[model samples]
Target: MLTEEMMTTTEMILMTYLFEIDEWLKDKKVIQQQQAQLTKEELVTVIKNDLTTFQANQATDYEKKLQTTLTTLEALSEAQFQKMKLEILSWGPNVKHVD
Candidate 1:
């Protein structure tokens, strides 16, 4: 019952709508890709920051351990020196001067 002209018009309208929808879909895909890229970049930044913080903490712990070791060694050396000096003094009056 439809005329040929009417059918041609209807086909043209449908094609136009299909083209618009395709363009919209392409734009949506591009937006999604951009968002995904931003998310990836943000994640990378966070990981780098976390790694930096962790390295700093490890260095601080190592420095503290080194300081403690050095302090302990210094204390031991001081005690040994005191004992040796006392022993030398106890040999008083009988110690020969080696010229």
Candidate 2:
């Protein structure tokens, strides 16, 4: 079981990471809406923007999954971190396969 100090440290780290991810996703969604109004050539100018947004969303989702696993692990003593690490790794090879 985590000492109070360890739990507090973990909570801070998790909160900061989650906040960053949430902000990134919000920014991405705004950019994506703007992208939706572009002409083909103009849209090409923002393709990288779109791709970055897509990746951000994917990362956020994976991080959320990891966070949930961590929370459960903290209480259950399961190897949640390692299991979530593997799940995160599996997503890397297929990142560009987005539709």
Candidate 3:
């Protein structure tokens, strides 16, 4: 039905349209690849950012816990020193001399 010797205008138009469709499909594939690469890059950036924030938060939480422990230790030391002082004072007036 198709030959170069008897080529029709309708056949020429159909061939042109087929070539255009192939070109369009190629262009679409290229664009999709580019978009996929961009999406991957953006995801990596977001993950890095989240990891940094999580590390910062962990550091801050550790520092706060350290400070709390130090404060509690200091308070206990102070209370122990006061108790010793009170006991010594109480023994002063009630101490009996061994003659």
- Each model's lDDT comes to 0.35, 0.38, 0.33
lDDT tens digits, residues 11-69, model 1? 33222222343544454211223222323234234434443555653466534433333
Candidate 3 residue 61 C-alpha distance from true site, Å: 0.2
* lDDT digits (tens) for residues 43-87 of candidate 2: 233433433554653467544444433443345333444443233
Give the range where candidate 3 is weakest over 10 consecutive residues by summed lDDT.
9-18
lDDT score for residue 26 of model 3:
51
Model number with the top lDDT: 2
Better of 2 and 3 by TM-score: 2
Candidate 3: the clashing residue pairs are: none
Per-model TM-score on C-alpha atoms: 0.20, 0.24, 0.20
Among the numbered candidates, top TM-score falls to 2
Model 3 misplaced stretches (Cα beyond 4 Å): 1-59, 78-99
The deviation in Å at residue 66 for candidate 3 is 0.2
Candidate 3 lDDT, tens digit per residue, 38-86? Answer: 2323423443444355565346653443333323323334444345223
TM-score computed on alpha carbons, candidate 3: 0.20
